[model samples]
Target: MTLKLAIQSIGVVYGDLGTSPLYVMSGIFPDGIKHEDDILGALSLIFYSIVLIGLIKYVFIVLSANDNGDGGTFALYSLICRYAKASLTPNQQAEDKEVSNYRLEVPSRRLRWASAMKSLLENSKAAKYLLLVVTMLGTAMVIGDGILTPCISVLSAVGGIKKAARSLGDDQIMWISVVILIFLFQVQRFGTHKVGYSFAPILSLWFLNIALIGIYNFVKYDSSVIKAVNPLYIVQYFMKNKKEAWISLGGVILCLTGSEALFADLGHFNILSIRLSSCLVVFPSIILTYFGQAAYLRKHAEDVASTFYSSIPKTVYWPTFVIAVMAAIIASQAMISATFAIVKQSLALGCFPTVKVVHTSRKHEGQIYIPEVNTLLMLACVGVTLGFKTTLKLGNAYGIAVIFVFNVTSTFLVIVMVMIWKTNILLIILYVLTIGLTEFMFLSSVLYKFLEGGYVPLVFTAMMVTIMFIWNYGYRKKYEYELENKVSREALVTIMSNTNIHRVPGVALFYTELVHGISPMFTQYVTNVSSLHSIVVFVSIKSLPISKVPLEERFIFRQVEPEESGLYQCVVRYGYRDAKMERQFFEKVLIDRLKDHIQNDVAPATDKQGEPSDHGIAKVNEESVQKVIGVLDEAIKSGGIMYLMGEREVIASSGSGLAKRFVINCLFNWLKRCVRQQEEVFNIPHKRLLKVGITYEV
Candidate 1:
């Protein structure tokens, strides 16, 4: 990455880290800082936590665990799934491995544990669900972070209004916050790309402004606060205040809130950019700002609740407040975009409902806008701001979600390091000791505040977990049902050949989840109509785990037996990161491939007497194929074409347990009702689409 991009990355990737100093102190000491030791200890914890977790674990380690270029919880899962063959998606094809990054090599004896882990995941269905839960927990927390980060960051920034004008009330701050938030979310459709360039200048000014303010405060009061850099102060603080010190970890964790975003957004920017911008600009700036806040707090012990504003010089308070709000908005923007990206990944992985995903920038596929999700997020953000009403309460809620997400990311990291990277077991142990222990301390502390605002994220996490689990479970059951009940290829061919069945004139494209044989929906449709189209095509659209499929390998065609019957099956494969093409483009590609198959693979039509019939057809050649395509195009245009899809409702069997029945008959079905039908999901024209309703009890 160029230095320019690295600078730009600071605005996009490090906004949360850049603005963290606004509330980290208050989050650490909600009731105000009383003792000098507490200031030293909190600063010590913040400094070390940033170094250990933010720099070592994420900047250096977890960043490398990205799948192709994409990063996030699901991206890690995607990489592991590729190597282990432990994917839940049933249509995983050998062509998926053709991607450059999906290459596999023989495992050495050192990978025994890795192999065993893969075996455990592959051999157990329970393990898959467990993996899904863990992954979605991280995902859900990210979504929750999308909600909480803005509430706290913007609220804290706007709280400065009270500091500047002590006459202002809480209601005023909140109303301003709500308006800003509404505007923030409302503009997401335009995307960051349009205004992305402006972010760097604002962030740079914000960083420069904070660092200057921090240095001035550090020199003006308690310059010796720099001594907090020693590790001994951390021990002294914990040793002195015991339980209070332990609980304080939840607050201290606020410093590292945006570190996960570094890894989550690895796809959008290069690691070099992330490292350079974070280490050079963001890290030092936040460290200085935190230390400066601690220094000022050590002198004016009552300023903890408003340290950020009070520490600002009178001359620059207005500019500082403006910059703070801008920074907060940028930080919220990063998390919100990350949520959209994660949801898109989940949809591709079949863990989410098929929501409309609009790519905001054609140049960058990752720059997407989900209107439904954005609106929901906006409402939730507004609710959170209205509910918490203060930075401290939101901080309590924020720490839990972020810390637990860190725990999830760390757990997945350990697995990837062991199984994929094949790191030394001893190093892994040290990694777990340092990173895992810190995250656990924070997680435990945050959990202790369960009755306090921490319950909010837990509630959100539970809701998301239920949604993801049901969607995945329901889809898995549907897939298994299809596997069990799909009509056999030979049987389908026999049915097609049966002269008793009436043949209709038209081209019908049957869409199905199943790749090899006819879907049970097709069986039902055929049984009801007791008729077949003149040209029947079975089309299956499959999503691979990779980021992008090669153009040449996007479409695969197979001719069903007795080609004279005009039966064919084709699989159109797209990677999870691939852009969904227009319906017309898809139709053209499918028809062209079908034409190619007919000219090259399928034999010419034959008469009942076993003689080749010309039927006014041209000979087989490159030029003749075009003439043939024109003839076929005329037939397609005149005969008319229809896209056939199934609308399936999964019902619970009579013997199913109460819990299973609720999941299938209630939760899953409710979600199914909410999701768009396949034709709508694929952007197929409604006028040319036919839906076949089918009920399956599993």
Candidate 2:
């Protein structure tokens, strides 16, 4: 099973990194190779970058920091948040720690600096916000990569048509790429599982083809290109062409483009599987391909722009081209899928707006389709494809997004090493200087091209960061409002006991974000309508940052008042990767759990003779349980399950600054309007749902 997954990971996890060779050489020498030694320098840099960053840092170190089995920036944040009170969401409770997978390791010896760092993060609001901003920036850049990857990968692959038919114009190739991209995204609705069978085979074939061709080129052209593996060439290349070489780091960074996906997609495969696939299959194939490309470039400098295609043997060019295109599609699909996943995670964590998420596969929880996000990606991808007609410009934008994510991951990884892993401070500093310095160099090169197409990701990231910030801000404020104005148990009793407020004969589920208290929305509803349900369940659907909450631990129930009050608090916990339950199934499960809770509560205590100690008391308890059970069953039979949700309009407090007002009144409000309603998210039937409106000034 592990071997199968490792092979399968080749298509999904390594597609982007594998397809990178199609453009890396071309991107590095866009204007064609200036000096033969420059090829050696470029090769050296690529070799070491893969070894240090890709192999050592990510595959070995970063992968070990995964939150349970999940990876990515959010996963890293979750790790830290789990260890400390750094998360902005106040909803996290002591009960959350009881979750089965919410595991933490205590170091044998705690470092003082680690403790101090955790303290600083927990104590400082600014530090927490900064951490969130950094994570969001990484997430936004990944989304940007989702847009730009397809554009560049497909464009680079399709651009190879010029090598075969020189008569074909650039405009023609661009449109062809646009069409392929459109088609690739169009098939996403079918889910990766539908077409996933072919991805592995195609990608595996691609790697094999590239490896064989690389060896052929090395033997036929110049085998001495193997000497480029020496790190000294990197120094000599830099010393000879300092500024140009520095600038070219932007293109060189592209070699590590899809490396982030390795970590991001960790939830789908185990650490051992990923490590095995990347180290054994991906690394060797890619290194060989780059070396072969450098060898070809050393001899035929003019063909640098189309190095991969130009180097291919004449007999198999068309077949390799076909596989390359397919691999490009696979690569694009992986990133697009990853984007949907992260957005879904963001939504679950309340960092993103509640967009409609379609679970595309029942078997694969990770396979999801967001219509809104998919459409936006399609438009952005098409726009980028047309706007950056040349791979060179697209590479500029692509490199920045990839490297920015790398830098963010590096920052987070360092913190994880210190606080979570409790690694030696000296080793952590070494990691910082080595990986950090390398990424900084790459980041600098990419940022240098900010105006030259790099602004694409920066602009997109700013927009995403703004949306995320506004949504999270509003979400936190509304939660705080609920916390402040939660209806007390006494207040709830008073409302229920009111003579004018008649009790309806239905099971009313008042859906709220509050887990422990009666929602203010419920108070507003009862006050205005002068009615209450005989049985009320305040349902708080909580999404945890982990991948999947265990089924046994899904529903948590607490009685708000005495048994006679018929008010219960049910917290339905879900993990980020867990799909939202259907309304009917969810209600059934809740009712079953409620009955189980009642039965457990009223279970009779036996005497030494194995008889009920208090028969009269047991009878009353049994009758009460039967009565509640009958009411619940009747409600289900008569279709009397009503879902009541709060529709809040958030506004800035009058005492706030102008910016706060604009953010709350304008940006946050507009975002709220754009997202799906709570009723819709819960999949409540229109006839069975009632929305209560409330206003809050934050």
Candidate 3:
């Protein structure tokens, strides 16, 4: 984490928080400007919210609850999944334990309560699904954040135009906002890397200007506003305003909207860089800016509607407005990119539909572009902007998503602290009391506005959660069917030994979901055709819980029987972050490994005529088993490789209830169709692919 990297991080990570002062004051005082005491109280709430939630909880605590270097809702889930045996992915091989992030360091003497919690999660199907739903809810809220952050930030910034020219109407402001949003989303295809360097300097200047202006305002308009820093002011605020103060926390929540970005973007920047940037640059600047705005509002209370724009010293208004707009775009960019990353991770873990993920940076796997998601997000952001048409209204919808995700992250962190970190129980209670209570206050406030645009994110969240549920439920049912119905290894070996069945020419790679044993699809194929390939390879591609698998340990090869069977099984494992290899890369690696295995030791030589002799075919050192590698290599070179995959139509069983039938037959089937084809996902060419369709009942 160099000084340069920290500065760059400020550009990317702090955009939302940096731009909050633009709308936070007006949002809190939407009815009208308040008295001097109320302004001080609002300032107090905003300041402490930043200190408590932003700087302390997220920056210091929740950021540490990441898997390896990754953070976010799924990252926390992945960490817990690795520690406990609660992952929905059932095929856990010994090799998977070797991944870098698989931390198996639980206390040898497990606590009874911790062990019970783990057992309940792992043993009960309903508990496990509930956990998945909880995680998906958090992820969906983040997606909601991606939609709302841009609408509020950009609209608020453009609304400043009205401050300059009082004649500008809402329609003109909306058109300007829509144009800016169009431009912002239009450039997404080029990726953030191309324009990343410029972000640091622009954000740095934005912070410096805000801080300088804040200092100027503090001196010019009642430096006494500094007294609002006391916690007693927060008490005074609630006492003075009662229920209104509690409701106003929804507006105060805006200050901490991007606080999670400090943690979620941890993979892009190290903790030290994020921490230093937050403390040295982001935090001080934002607090002073808020205080400055509060001071300006204290005297010119009538200007509370646009304190951020009006209070800007006339000397630098134009530069500040331009910089604020750029900063808002940068903030929206960070949130959008984070949404893509989360969706990609979800796809790898079988929780999302298989959308096309385009790697934007050759050097960074995390830098990606998803056209489907991008277009959807653009449409949603535009809808929110045009529909709400005001920053205050958008702010009402915005805080709910952020607050919900914050509460989810806090709840999961408590479990991690107790079960994984095994922190002192007393300290854990305090965390729940302090952090949990603060978040609940904000959440309650936001939910109070459910009918007033707050329902917007709730609708989005519900839609996303339904998608995830259908996907995961469908995935689990299919896996269970495969596991229960797969042919035993002995039965598969016997089928291979039946010499009466004709052996065809060329190599056949039967793609299976199972890591071991013959897939039901293979049985279906052989039962129908009554024949086998000259060389049959059962290839299973498994996604592990870790982020990346080391290249040397990716594939595990095993012979299906004694040397002459002409059958083998290859298990190729990938971590969630690993790129799907191209067909050429897959074939090259598989063939090289098979060739090495053939040449390594004593094996028999069997000729095309089935005659066993020392010189009959390419030999290792034994008779009757030879030239297998030669056959496979020649077949691959001649484009004679064929891929056999099972296309399953998941249907409702006769005994399934109506709800289950509807979910499986309706929602899951639709989602399955939207997923990428097996051939494309695994980089297998469709020209040489054969599909075997089966109707699977759950």
Candidate 4:
């Protein structure tokens, strides 16, 4: 099973990194190779970058910081939230601690530094906001990668056509690449289970083919290219061509384009499988292929524009070209799938709007397809391809997104070492000096080309960050309103006991985000109609930070006041990766759990007037249990069930500043109107659903 997973991960996890050889050499020397020794210098930089950054920083260190089995920026934030009071949501309760996987490792009291850091984060509002902004920035960059990766990979591979048919124009290659990208995204609805099985064999064969071709080129042209492994060449190359070499770092960084996917897709596969695939298959194949490209460039520098295809032996060029195109599609597919996963995670954590999420595989919870996100990605990718019309410009855009995510991950990793792992301060500083300095240099190089094409990602990221911030700000304010104005138990009792109020013969499920107390929407309903249902259940759906909550621990029940009041509270907990339950299945589970709770916890305590009669306590408990169950069954059979939901309109207060007003009244309201409604999300029937409208000034 482990071996199977390792092989499978190669297709999904390493496709982007593997197919990078198609463009890396060309990107590094877009104008043509100026000096033969420059090839060796660039090769040395690639070798050490893969080793120190990709292999050491991510595969070895960062992968270990995964929250349970989930990875990505949000997962890191969740890990910190669980350890300290870092979450902005105030609905967390003591009952949440009873969950089986809600594990926390508290720092020792003697570790005052760790304690102080946790204290600062928990007590300071500015610190919390800063942390959230950083996380959103990272998430936005990953989405940027999703858009740019497909453009560059497909364009670079399709450019190989010019080597075969010298008469073919650049426009023809662009159209071909666009068509291939469309087809690739069109098939994503089939899910990774089907796509991955087929892709694994293709990617595996691609690696073997490239490695063999690389060895052939290395031996035939110049085996001495192996001498480029020495770090001295990196220094000499820099001294000879300082500014040009620095600018080339933007292109060199493309070698590590898909490195984040190795961590982002961790939830779909295990750590051991990712590590095994990277170390044994991906790492060696990439090194050999790059070395071979360097050797070829040393001899025929004019072929630098189309290095990978130009260097291929004549007899095998067609076969390799076919594989390269397929490999490029596979790489794009991996990034597309990863984008879906991260967006879904963001939605679960309340940072993104609600979109339709389709579970692509019944067996794998992490495999999902969002039609909305897929359509957007497809359009963006095609536009980027046609707009750029060259790999050089797309590479400039891609480098910024990739390196920004790297820097964010590095910042979070240092926090993890200090707070979670308790590593020595000196070792953490050492990590900063080595890995941090390298990424900072890459970031600088990419920023230098901001006007050339790099502004694409920055502009996209700013837009995303703004949307996320506005949504989160409005969400938090609405929750605060609900918490502040919630109807108390005594107030509900008074309303229920009013002489004018009448009991309707149905079961009512009031859906709310509040975990405790009755929603103000309910108060408005009863006050207007002067009636209450025979039985009322306040249903609060909460999403945790983990992947999947255990089935046995999904529902938590509590009585509102007393069993005879016919009011109950149900907190349905789901982890970020868990699928939402369907209407019928969810109703059945809720009713069954409610019945069980009535029999076990509420029956015996119902008769509190005096001691039991000669019939004894068991007899009294049995009678009470039967009576309550009989009432519940009768209500379900005769009156049916209705779902009551709150529809809120949020507006800014009069005293708010211009920025807050814009975020709340304009941007947030527009987003709320655009996203899916509560009734649509839960799939409630129109006849059976009742919506209560309320206005909130935040």
TM-score leader: 2
TM-score of each candidate structure, all chains considered together: 0.94, 0.98, 0.93, 0.96
Off by over 4 Å in 3: 104-113, 596-626
Candidate number with the higher lDDT (2 or 4)? 2
Sliding window of 10 residues with minimal summed lDDT for model 4? 605-614
Candidate 2 residue pairs in backbone clash: none
Deviating ranges (above 4 Å) for candidate 4: 104-110, 603-615
Model 1 stretches with alpha carbons more than 4 Å out: 104-109, 500-506, 596-631
Per-residue lDDT, model 4, residue 53, is 92
| The best candidate in terms of lDDT | 2
The better-scoring model by lDDT among 2 and 3 is 2
Can you write out model 4's per-residue Cα lDDT over 1-698, one digit (the tens) per residue?
A: 87888998988888889989988887788778888999999999999999999999999998999988889888888787776677787878787778888885655543665677788888998888888899999999999998998888899888998987989887888999899889988888888534765689999999998998889989999999999889999999999999999999998999998999889888878899999999998889988999999988889999887888988999999999999888888888888888888898888778888788888776777678988899999999999888898898888999999999999999988887777777778888999999999999999999999998999999999999988888888988988888888998789778767889888888999999987677788888887778778888999999886767887789988878745778888999998878988789999999999888888774443346655444566687888888888988988887889888888888888899998899898889999998888888788999998888898887
Residue-pair clashes per candidate: 0, 0, 6, 0
> RMSD, each candidate, Å?
4.2, 1.6, 4.4, 2.6
Find the 10 residues in a row with the least total lDDT in model 2. 190-199
Better by TM-score, candidate 4 or 2: 2
Q: Rank the candidates by TM-score, best first.
A: 2, 4, 1, 3
Ranking by lDDT: 2, 4, 1, 3
